[model samples]
Target: MFHPQQEQGQPSCRQNTEETDTDSDESEYNKAPDAPLTPHNMQTMLRKATTDIKSHLASELDKRLSGIKEDIESLTSRTNHMEARIKELTTSSQAHSQDSTYLHAKIEAMEESLEDLNNRSQRNNIQIRGLPEAVTMEGLHNVLKGLFKSILPEASAQDLLLYRAHRALRPQGHNGPPAFLRN
Candidate 1:
């Protein structure tokens, strides 16, 4: 239904025949025969159009601001989650580094102990190899007793032999003697 404010002969209050004709003429003028728009001029026009469009969009799409805000909030939450994950990973990496350092120290200590054991075993083996195969256990004990008495008068013969036997069984490797001996 046309309101009284509408111009005579027009069907709707918002429609104006003169305005429509003017818009049509302007559109035709925009397409007039001339040099094609240059890139620099087109870019300037595009920038101006974008600025106007953004201004119009800001005014017309005000109702969508709340939705945009919600989207921003979700993105922020995801970013926060990623930061927390990175922190967790960093902490775990540090802990793993500490664990690795401790394990390395333990391995070094074990290696030193094994080296000492190997040296002692080698000395005992040299001593045993020097002895005569015909030497009886009793003769061996007496020999050790005399040796200990000469060097360490305070040590007993039994104690000296026992120490020598312990030295002979000293470890020979990092893990132990070998798979056969370990088993």
Candidate 2:
């Protein structure tokens, strides 16, 4: 059938051109469109595309690596700062512990001094129980110096420091007629 290629006096590459004359002008015209795109040209274009893609990928990888490196360095710096803070905290803790130990020792010493002071105040005190409660406080006081001196003949009136004395309660349920005395 008469088609557009037939009207142009050209053979279509889709037909069996090999069965016809291989030296026809239409056959040469059919191959003209692919003449400039040789294997060498295609290979050179593929090489350039490969080189460009590789260079672009390399640049992208470099950017990612730099970002990761910066992140690692920042993390390391933060870790170092945390470690220093921990060290400072450890030192502060030790200082607080030492302060606590010192305070504990000082408190113990103060307690001991307070106990000694209490003992010293009571050193001159005397309590005489089972004395006759029938006597008045003046009567008890009058005989107290002589009674204390009788116990220690080595003591004089100056050494016999007798303080005021008074009566105390008897046993709670006791019906005994005599109450207790203190001097």
Which portions of model 1 show Cα errors greater than 4 Å?
1-59, 127-183
Instruction: Give per-model TM-scores.
Output: 0.37, 0.50
Best by TM-score: 2
TM-score of 1: 0.37
User: How big is the RMSD of model 1?
Assistant: 16.1
lDDT (CA) per prediction: 0.61, 0.68
Cα lDDT for residue 78, candidate 1: 100
RMSD of 2: 12.1
